[model samples]
Target: MKKQTLLVAVLAALSVQAGAAVPEKTADTVLKPQPGQTQAAVWASRVLTKLHYKSTPLDDAMSEKIFDRYFKSLDSEKMFFTQADIDQYAVVRTRLDDAITGENLSVPFAIFNLYQQRFNERIAYARELLKTKFDFSTDESYQYDREKVEWAKTDAEVKDLWRKRVKNEWLRLKLAGKDDKAIRETLDKRYDSYLSPSRKLTNEDVFQIFMNAYAMSIEPHTNYLGPRAAEAFDIAMRLSLEGIGCILQSRDDYTVVREVIVGSPAALSGKIKVGDKIVGVAKDDKTPMTEVLGWRLDDVVALIRGPKDSTVRLEIVPADAGPDGKHATIALVRQKISMEEQSAKKTILEVKDGNVKRRIGVISLPTFYQDFEARRKGDKDFKSATRDVARLLAELKKDKVDNVLVDLRNNGGGSLSEAVELTGLFIDKGPVVQQRNGENKVEIESDTNAGMAWDGPLGVLINRGSASASEIFAAAIQDYGRGIIIGEPSFGKGTVQTLFGLDRFSQNDKVHYGELKFTIAQFFRINGGTTQLRGVTPDIKLPTMADSDSYGESSYDNALPWTQIKPAVYIPAGEVKEIVPLLDKRHEARVSKDKDFQYLAEDIALVKKQRKENSISLNETVRRKERDTQEARSKLREARLLATPGADDPILVPDPKDALNKAIAAKPASGKTAPVPKVAGVKGALRSDDGLQGSERTLAAELEAEKAAKAAKDVLLNEAVHILADEVGLLKTDTRMALRVLPYAADTK
Candidate 1:
């Protein structure tokens, strides 16, 4: 997984009550054809053609076809409508067709009003249907008790449902009083507080509610964002806005921090971390803080993010801590976080086995990011993740690194264009990903650029956060045997959103409606496989605390299913299957004996278990017990590591002489604290073939610090030199090495 992957809002609007009875329309109010109508029709026809809508000479027949399709989608089961209603709808459809074709504004406008009226009636009926418990499946399979529709006939039964809703709301207030009066006051206060907002409910509010209900019926990810939410939606895609630099969600009335960006203000500040519950937010350091305990995530985010350099104070209660948790005010100054900030940085690690050494250059990409704003602004000097990694690879080559590990742990993908471009960096170009639209039209995305940057033994690491473009690139590499993928399943977010300009059609009072964001396309790998619900599977599975399977597009409320398209013509690069067996053996051996692997696995399991727990006892005694348990667990792990075989020996401590001296004395002479020298042989009594092992190596290793820092190349680079040297028997090669021909996945091949 590329580091640039993980980059990725909520609205709270109330529903409205509708009139019990429906109204009828008269013929006199219907639009009459005028002499200038033909000209208007021509204009409308030209506009639709320009917009690339399937115009098909939209006359009476085309209009009727569109109406049938629309109606079927609305009532797919053919329920709720009587024969008479169907006949009436057909007549209305014909009238609407004529109105639209004739370009008569009155008819279409009148039709819209009738549609709204009917939609409201439908909503009222649906609300009533809720009283009659319909079999609603929690899962997508929809396998449930669908034997009968039990309608609530009595007023008591209907009120019971209302009471359940009220109880749920009250429970959200954290009220637990044996006395009825106190609990009642708490419930009333909760309701009053929510209702006290002076914001007036407008027609747009009603539209949003309707749109959300409509979208929800489709799927969870398919959401309707009224014009008001367009700004936020756009910002999410661009991924260049300032906030706590974390994704947030409303998990049961509490806005929880989902994931923290690696180097974001939230992560850097080290104040508000993941799993912390935001209790309240004070804007511009206001004295009166608005309690956000039960606010929607979007509402909370709005308060959190502002203009660059502005500060928003947050009061957070750490999840590890209790309600009376230590509350601190941390002021964060916002900055324009660039794509470069979210990119992958290269680090070389030298792994030693006996006398042999291997250099693994790790490119830890925080995200698959591109400077989209800069690109859009027509700035040719845009920061590109793929390009940056290429440069890093070149630098590593100069150090004579052996292998490359692409760390994409928490990378959420950004910019489809960048994905294709990055995919090109590794292979002889071909189609990387396929995008299938709603119309079944497939668009093949490829790396048009020529050549590969660095094609040594490649391994890509991904986790649950890797999605979309990340999936695209990873799938291509895995399918083509270009690289071995490691980690958990990638996040399945393969849907392409098409933003429709709603303002073009209608206007409500002052604010014009913006866009109708819909899933217009689905992403597929070059192998004709879609990364929709089931994200790309890794080649070498690694231990991850993340439960990517529990969340993401497939698990989402309205996510599209995983499917496939016609396979593109391509061939596997080489046989990397041997590496899989090697990795599996290595992993098993490590898991069996390595203390770090065991500890990491246990830690992940513990965290996952902790995440599943709901309410914790707030009592002081229980809280203290929990804290003590955590402390005990932490100490136990630390003790276990210290007792491990290789670590049990006494170690040398560092002093003012610096890390080099400390490294020389640590446990084994080959110290873990210092960097190993890259030269063919060490000075003094140390010979190239002296072959120091274990504790000796630990103690003898030179502390990689001041000397390495002042040197042209760092200690890590020097270690990499030793690894690559051991590989090709070029340890004595003093000549500087450079990448001769970098490979690129060919898009047009």
Candidate 2:
């Protein structure tokens, strides 16, 4: 992990959104309010019904008190808030409990109002603290210090921290090129956007933060799925959306790009790389831009992501620049991102050892995904990722691939059932994993039976993005010694979520309908090892992400501790130790001074340094200089790769006479045609951005249409065949990871 603390914070922020807002609703049995009943009580009754609360005989005062207590307890330190901050919230909390018991609107409304007010105050405090400084490196340290101090001491301490922090931040800002005037102006703009009435900060912001905190408190996996948040996630996973195809996050005041999907219009346009701060968004040059400083990341994303085929202009402060730097407006076109690009496809490399030929099979699984909607509709034709993988394996087997490499890098897991099924493809009948629910009950999911698809020398490649179900599959394979695990430690997401419907309890038109995602279970490896904060250990120790933001379980806030129940019996295929030295040697030889690897290493270091800083200048000139340096570096890297032989060579289509390639494309499912040929003399070879036919085809004349179609169909299979022919039955490297338990956490890689 780059900085363990920062990594943990970011992971917590990302993972805690799964199993949140566990709603505990009661049935609203109240028929109606009495004629002489107070308006507060009458209104409360109706509201309770609408909210799906089971109306009890209890009165208004009690309900208010209960709700108040729940809110305060969740934020006791006033880091969000504490009981001491208010004089009579204690009474209000009591009243809330009573209000929920009966249908009293007055007390319920009052409680709701109080909650909103306190929530607003909490948001204010959080914003202020962002601008302040602190010596505390961890949340625990901050909590401890907060608890020890009295009110007066706390106030003074906070003030002192702020002064010191602000001064340091200001210095960084100056270096980034912001003068005092620019700084003031920027701050004024931010204040207007964040605190203005039009923004709805007091209501919407508080709601969001409260939901986030609530999710974190329950369990790392549980989360409140706000409509907008859900929408954002869907767009991200689909790898397509309007506006820019960049993932953004809020760090204190600025909105930063966390990741950029490769080949997106933004990436293709040579504009707006990761870590860029989005200062403003506009529809066109004639339109006035909206400054987004100090806004929530979600809100900023909402503004950027819109309808498909639409364009949005962004004013960006590229990383490595100061204030008063040149801000460029980048235009981007939204296009559907092909999932195949992210998947593990095949490539053939020629390797000769004393006239011996070997073939290697590369299959990339980007997230263990199975489209739930398609499955639920009983659509047998629905895209089953496992099925595709199984077919790929079968084809590879025909190609006589000597070794198989399963790439799972950047795959944040999906579809639990798919994980088990995917794992089943490699092993015989056995327990896959154990799940422990809230009541401490356990259920073991087992593979019914298994026939190995293509069990040649296998290697599973993982990275930080490989999490949850992905971790489970990788861990199982590692434990069984079925394959070698390569790359980095898997993401620690051991929890399982269950959705609870809230619509069933609501009454009337107020629509208290929603879903509560709760962490109902924790996943355990068959060997009885927990993958909670400690993800699966890789077999080969790779030197990557050593200083990257990718974090293990321990990095997450309030993450569940790693523990074991009992190990499930599992048989080992082979010990990985026998090939450790050879794998190490190969990796060393392959990566040593390799330009691509070296560039990646340098990029990671620079990014780590950039993330650690808190403030930068608002000046234009300085910012432009920084942006230029980054752009130049990127262009240089691209040029270098192009200069390398075979590195930038376009993929070639398989020839009909290629036997090894033909073996890889024996069959194709209906409606799923074979890949097109990449050869120059092919139909549908070159097209516009939106008209990209396939990776297998090259732009050519229509006179060669028939030949081109056949050629294109064999491209994927041909590559697979070539890989298999060269690597199959050759020597294999096994040592993938060096696992050890450090004092802080388990090292998966």
Candidate 3:
């Protein structure tokens, strides 16, 4: 909130609450900025109005929108606030436009204060309800997802919801085999932390949070970063951290592990998993574990991060946990994650077309990474996504692969320059993408590089997680008809953000205002369609982990709408549009008869069906049976796949020298390490003409690492290979039909 609102002592002067039943805050408040956040907010507002690509006006229309978004962010599920509370907040809701320019944020701060008071009431009542046991015998259902539900009318209404919530949590703990005493202790520690909400917060924190609600109300990608958040942002750009090596975010009251970096302590530990909810954290073996249920994501991060070799025990609720399942605690050592292991990797898959076997190369890019410092120092070998992928493409060409698949699953995007340059490797020189600024000015980013690396049949594999630069490259390839897109729709993060450090705007350097990361540009494909929310649709769809309806850009309410301008003039190279139908037909037929694909379809069907359910059975018997049935089915499917030949496809392992393969080497059956075996002409764990790499790794460690990698591989990628093979089959059948031929394509021969 703006600094001019009030001082810490002002709480004593106010006896009346603004619009809610909240009384004067008896607890202490974080110090507001002495100068009020007016300077920062006004500055940000002015910049955004002039620079943000959306160029949306900040009138009372946006003001009310911001008000709604602020509360939605604080209480996303509509559980904490009532219609009366919202009614009370109506005044401030109309004053944001003036307040932002005038440097007045009293209303926003007031709303936040009321939110805190309501949260306290809800949590305290929940603690009391936890004191008694719940009657699971009664057929009661709780709607866990209340995002679209109506606000409760009275305290009684909310109290009933909290009771069910508390009961459900207790039942899960009891199912996990914890005693009543243990469950109560856990609940106690969790609830007690809730009484104090802003204890660790600074004025900057409040200002950032309030302003971010405003900014994000304009669009999903625009945000405000406090000083601490800005520092962390820079650290992430460096792609290294001294911590448990897992990315974390606050989801509801739980701290969720978002991504586990390979070669880091979390990934190497073999215990941590993505989507795991961390409830409590302990330092070393002796220190008492502290509950972090109500802690801010940054605070949880601070607790998890420490000096190398320090032990951090994490009490985790597995991602797959049901309402009546147990959680476990695991200990891991803190270490530095350098992100070297997250670089682009290469492997080869052998696909059979008719009676002949063809080798198809695959490149997996985790992110669009670049070593800016190294490049600035004139290091020719500086690591970068474009450079690395280019080198890998050359290697694939040397091995004479028939087709190439670019695996961009879960690649959330980076480095726009890399995205443009990467597209150059596939298509002839032309406009790659168009960028429109806040002023409605358009600039075309083109690939002037005349050289092409891979002009053969190509496919890109994407899912809801592929975004930003991933969308740019994929869109450009699709626009140019350079490749066929396979898999789910990409994440619709077409907006471009630029970080501005607030210190530059300040006259005083002693105290730093935070930073603003606002959207400066939006990406448009060569076909002139903006990728804003309607991300690049794939040529063919594959069964995904989650449907786009449940995830991706379309899920956000404030995302920019997709639109189109005049298409950039460029001749299409390939008949991908015509070929896609044939490939789709073959794919449908293959997956229908394939056992692995059948199991995949069945699993996906189950998940989608489960997603429609608002409530699950509270009875322990029913829940246990559900879990057991799922497990039994999974085991049976696994056994069947393992027994079938070609059902177990091995991933191409990246060379150890390039990427950090620090995962615990797979143990050999005899407890002995063997040199990489010569198989299928695969050398050093890379592809050659002979066969696929199997024994190229020290057998003991190679096997284990391959096993781990295989378990994580989805059936979609193997399907992508089959689709690519079909394209190759088309090309072989009609050799006279030239498809997107590179000017220098003969050089590969």
Candidate 4:
């Protein structure tokens, strides 16, 4: 009999949740692959080998890559498993492909069991070390970047590395002004929290992690999403979820409310607040409450979420209440919570062009969103990025704006159709983007709309975070000469990912086999060049902290190479290229004297210098001095910018929800809508675009740092506005001169 046939017979007697029976010698519950998972592994492997853009075979060579990737995913810092463990597992390194293909998952599960054991040992050792005192005066450094380092050869070597790691943690708290007692308590809680999350990982989670290691070995974008992750992905894409409307995070075996969304049930109830701990949950008022204090976050969330209008009761300990304090019961009816924050928003900037004041409309799109379910239900007013943008453009046109700018600084793309439809709003009709499959067959995606929304002066703002669909829209606008692309070069992720729910391929509807997201096609600009690694180069580049080589798609190993095909048949919408040289010249002159721009350049230089360091000093005095120096420099720069003439605070714009509500209320009984009220323009903060940081600063200090970062971004937006204003002026005065092409950078194609 075949291995798959034998495995099917064995799986027939195993339980879905518990999987195969564990041995009596095992102290803790050992996670094993279920029957559905083995089937999914086989199906996913077949799909990747046959349909993936890379079309890489699942052979011994690929299996070795998956083996390395799996270990990296499990313990990238090389602190958990030793070289001996790796050597012991070497027998199965090149056999993973055969095992997956044959529907045998014993090797991966056995490896994961050993990893779990090693993880527990390390955590226990860390907890024990927290009981001892460390000398912070020692002049030693901890190399946190261990990606290129070899694994420890022995247990003693790993333990010594842990000693240095614990010391580094202690030094950070000490520099943050924590007392020895507080440091011990905090470290103890943190170590326990780390162990809690890892120990709570289910078999499904491990399977997803291992499968992704297999998929991404072929390319960076290919991934496998477990059932839980798949739901979260859908929520992100749809920008809405049916829940109580609060964010939760795991902390020391407790599910704590991190934030209460402004318009969520939790926010309206006024009973739940940030930092509150959820202790128990009940299906409804009548059902018995189930204690969930130590349950995994995803499990707790699953219990809390229900169908719309259904009641889910939560027992909580308030933020101000101690863990031993009284617990309160709160009942909230689940409802659709629209993540309006992620939706498109608009502001009108009154920029100065010489002595004339020009009104410029700016629309900030965080993502290309679409309510897929609502659209599939044939709802005429379904929410979509294109629909919202079209409405915003109409309102901006009514405000008599001279030009409009679409801000896509950190948009990581969504809904390829939305990108095409959004591009259609600017031009009458044209091909937006092209997709080439593995078979070299190209499909052209275009906008067949007959009319334009606002054919005025246009500008597109992008950064290293702008990718995929964002690149497509920006590239189309640039290719059609419809707008001037601004900011840094975008993230060069030109691949298209198609998500396949694995359960669809199975006969059993009761089992959730998770989902697979794999790259199917490569996106090409209408101008013929692929945006794979080169991304969409801006017509006018601005000062950015993002470096193309280190930050974008090119940074990933085995990323698809840049290529080009024959350009799609299209006509130029309007000529903005010839005038780009004048805009660039003016932009340079203005920013040269701008204080905010100078400060931003200096900060970027400091960040680049910091990125070069591989380790941090464990000495408290040295670390504290370094932190103080950087903080002091940041403060001085902020003060200088604040002192600069005309450096006003950002204007406040009306909330998008409030504006929409007002518009609806003002509509006539006959159904004609009234004009949206004009509110002061506001600049969207770019703090998140800078990426995450591990700072030991106080909350107040961090807030101030964020404020300074936003002020710097205002300078970039201000410069883009000025450039658009200049474009409007040049076009109005002399069309012939504005249409004259000048010698500048070569076209992207």
Candidate 5:
């Protein structure tokens, strides 16, 4: 009682809103518990409170956090509820700890029920608003980023916000030349999609979301996946299947294309990109694309994905397109390939570094993936990143490429074992990364493989999206003085998480509990510093949006801190640090005058400027003028670049059939690409007695990889080549890292 009183006083000092208990009434009914949900939630809580790296105490303080998170999750934008709603739910806010442990599953379900009710009302309001005409001439603006604002005091206040929100969207569509009738239909469909999904949110779904709110409060990556989501995880891990091969995420009530997976139908079609919105889908070329703006993600995915050789047409709103802006129709042929995602691709780029035209080999590795099934089956020719990259390096040697750029941008890590093995390709066997488990025990992971793959003029290209095994690989290269690290700091995802199946702990076969991902270990770089939050900083920094703290591991409030322990026992392979200054100097001079690089800088600055905007003018004429001015400037820039043939790709409506051909045509003259050599598809390059037969040559695979690199138009990669070229000409091969080393905190045998 004394400890609880003291904790309440401490929370009061902190002035946390959720910690305060105000006078309130408990609702009559909360959600009914699923058969095994109570036990699963309790088990998940115990594991989190015990094993998580933060080890946050399970007390009133944590209860307050969980309450606040649940409320925020239910109504983040405050569009669905008013202050009265928050006050009414106050009784259950402080009772979550009891609910989780004692099987009183009422509070979470009750809150979700209220949220669903409010959301339904909002959807109805939106539909009505769409029916009415918006006078865009009114001099008004919508404050879009509502995250910093407080909840509306009344339903009337929220309705006004939603009205302006609907009006702003309508105004944009009007500016894009959409008529009232078409705009109404578009909005109707969008609202319908949003409302339609609410019906699908079963008690299990709501429970999962509420539970995740608690799990996420502990740490960002740690979470509880319900059965449905767990099955999706199973599919994603399989890596490849027949579909459009487009990665998607739900943003702003639309399915946004996160990535057009390389070598897939989406990439070959060339209509999809990072921020493009899939507003509609069609079954075939003859059918009109169905609008999918507010549609559930899985439903939208089901509509697009089909069997191999089948076609799905997509209606896409390009990233830069405004509301009602021109939409492109793309049709893609689905192709099924088994675990081709793990394959390493190589491309040689021809660039002028001073008077010399250097053939810079760019080896693009998407992830550290291995065919676990094949390896388990004792297949010697099992496709693995280490083997593929090693073979690609050998091909690079054959081509006599002047320098190498290992592009690791946007690569969410996969296999940790593969990271060590890949590092082994560069430096002769040594310690790679240290794993620190839950008990503070340390284990050294090393690359014991013999023979260096390629040691000359290596550069690793990374971005803020790079993480986990990517960090391990980059840190090893930097620490060993093996290569020059370039681009923004990587995503600091060094903590290790293992999924715990909840079914194992359930009382009986009444219901199948899901899985809990709990952080159990931390990864330390070979140099002793953990890449938990402060990721591997580059030796040569590049212009990037990730330079800001808005992205990557640093953005999470509970992310682990950067700490240095002790360096592993290993000799420096070679010193590339000695040449960084020279590389940096050359890089600076080049980017300052380089047209492509200047465009990247200008684009980044413009994005940053736009991110600072607090509101947008809702006045129709003013908004149209602003849009026109921006569009005009973009068009003029595109025209100038097109005239000179710069690699900066202007938005174009491409014929799906020509995209692959055009990509192939973009390859440099000395570059090569082909089917993954006879070696790639076969077990071992060949039998000891067999001779090379068939049309499968290594040249085409190298050439295809080259073509893909050209299609991507990577600025950082080009600069890496220039930097490497400078090193080759100016620095001695015997150079070594001159940075002083820090010792390990304790010995790990």
Candidate 6:
């Protein structure tokens, strides 16, 4: 028999023995490597070893890292497997490298099978504990985050851990006003839901997880996407999908709506919302609802997707609702939903600076996006961030905005081409970024187009979530002295990835393979320093909730180190460095007396205190006291803000889709200019100036007050606008300063 066939036979024999030892429900199905997986494993290993930017050898050291990563991926909380299980699996710890290269997947498959068995056992134990009455009066605690803890030495110890976990769950529900019977039923269903998803896992799913462990061990960004995930990746890049128009994420066997795309059917219905748990799905009114509480997220997505105009019904539990709360069913028509929410949006902020009201055009860019499929098919008007912002800049000019601020806060970046094109719109054509490959060959990527968009004055706002293309654009604008880089340091991801289709490596047409997104190059700013580990530091730094060590690239153990190459030759647009000190000083003076800033500092302190705690008390009284204290503080802040002047006035920022539609509607048939709509004082906008939806108010008064506290005014953006206004005033008074800082402004138009 062939090696692959022999391996399959051995796996089947092992499955039979394991089945005889476990319950029939848990061991009825065993996952084994599919035929195509062996080929895929070999292909992925070859491509990664040869073509990866790091070019790290797949030696013993790498094998051990892969082993630990795989185990962590399987049981990050260290709740399933025992130390004995790890000892037994140690034999293959240093052999995974060879297995991956030689097409031997038996070891990985065997380990996964044991993990599944252990998981089912834990779930069963948890369900059994639900039958016992849990005492909320006990002064015990539960260490929920166990990533750094040692594994239990025996099965009994693991069971003890699960006992505390179950007790904590019971206490949480009881605190949420659930009765004893309801708590038991909710927990019983939750544990069973956990087992259902594990039981449905396929061989392909296990293979994908193991492969990603190997890939991430080599580098942080390198990843393996299975066939289904590959298609999803394409859809994300195109920014369009035929579905109910919401992003879904899997959280503990529950499919949660992460975001409701604006202008999509779900958002129009105003029924679906972020943090809503999708428990069931139905094709139409006639079809019976299929319970999908424990279904895989991709499987649930498949059920939600259909032809345009088709109706899909979903049962959801609201975010504010407890697990035992009521569920509501909503029917929505599927459509080709363009992710217009991610597009660039503009709003004019009127800032009063020493009796001079300066109109600051603030553009919030969520990502650098492009519709690649449409662009490839020769569509001239294919959606892109650059094109949209260019149009917005022209409209801002017509509105007589004094300066422009591009808000890239929490923009995790998208297309590299769009970043370059967008940067081109700011400066008069120069090198934007540099690419360095494995061979150490450096190539410059420049914006060759010559022009300027809103060159009067500019600022780029960023935060820890800004990365890749966002960093590229910000770094370019900063390097050319074109704009003031504001806010927190970026996410520090400077590497570039190239997606490779795995099916191209094999000749067999029947089998569907996945894709590999591997790092191929590193990106450097025009000033020569790479943003690998040290993300772009803003010209005017703002206070952040967390330090760099708490998050960003520095948090990744295997992330690439910061480096520098030869700087690309480029002309500076103006001397922003000369005026940064004055801008920073003025900003500091204003925020020092600002009540909102003081509240922000207090919130940051509270977050830091919470982050330091690794465990929570299981006593219901102690937990409730802590919760009440938090609610009291939130109410105090809300009352203070409400007492401030203009607190009730809504800050009007137009929705991207609404703004685009109005701009189109305002155009005339005679080709004559019509009065452009005033971009201010529109009430009850869907999104705030900070790019987040207004919090949904709950029925509970305290909870509503807490949400209201969170929905306070955007102090950071307001400060940025003030800083820009100050710069405008400084330049207007000094002719020499104007000549030094406003060189590009004269060349505009």
CA-only RMSD, every prediction: 16.5, 14.5, 10.9, 7.9, 13.6, 8.8
Tens digits of per-residue lDDT for model 5, 469-548:
89999999898888889988889888877778888887676567788877778889888888888788999999876534
Kindly provide the TM-score of model 2 when superposed on the true structure, using C-alpha atoms: 0.55
My TM-score estimates for the predictions, one after another, are 0.51, 0.55, 0.76, 0.86, 0.74, 0.81
Per-residue alpha-carbon lDDT of candidate 4 for residues 1-749, written as tens digits (9 for 90 to 100) = 01111111122111122211221223377877888899989988888899898999999999999999888777777888999999999999999999898888988888888987887788789889998889878898887767668989999999998999888877766766778898887777666655554555567756876897898899989988777667777887889999888878655567888666665777667677666889899978789998887776667778888898999999999766788999999999998988887999898877655677778889999999998989999999888999999999999877888889999999999999999999999888879999999999999999998878977778999988999999999999998888999999889999999998778888887877778899999989988998898888899999876855457898877799999999999988766777888889988997888777887888898777765676778887898888788667766665655443362322333447767865554443445443221222222232221111222222233445555555553667777887887887887687455443211111211
lDDT of 3 by residue, 523-606 (tens): 788898977787878999987675666478888777788777777888765667777888899989988888777788888888
Clash total of candidate 4: 0
Over 4 Å off, model 4? 1-27, 131-138, 547-550, 637-713, 737-749
Write down the lDDT of every candidate, Cα atoms only. Answer: 0.52, 0.52, 0.71, 0.78, 0.69, 0.78
Residue by residue across 553-654, what tens digits does model 2's lDDT show?
Answer: 666545677888888776665455445455556556655655666776788778666645533333335544665577667665645543433432223324
Better of 2 and 5 by TM-score: 5
Residue-level lDDT tens digits of model 1 in 637-723: 545443422422212222234346433433222222322223222222212222121212211132222223233222222222222
Candidate 3 CA-lDDT value: 0.71
lDDT of 2: 0.52
Candidate scoring better on lDDT of 1 and 4: 4
Clashes of each: 47, 77, 9, 0, 20, 0
Q: Which one wins by lDDT: 1 or 3?
A: 3
Over 4 Å off in model 2, which ranges? 1-198, 201-208, 227-361, 391-402, 438-441, 544-550, 574-577, 585-749
If the candidates were sorted by their TM-score against the true structure, best first, what order would they fall in? 4, 6, 3, 5, 2, 1
Q: On a 0 to 1 TM-score scale, where does candidate 4 land against the true structure? A: 0.86
Name the regions of candidate 5 deviating beyond 4 angstroms: 1-32, 234-238, 241-343, 371-383, 507-510, 547-549, 640-712, 731-749
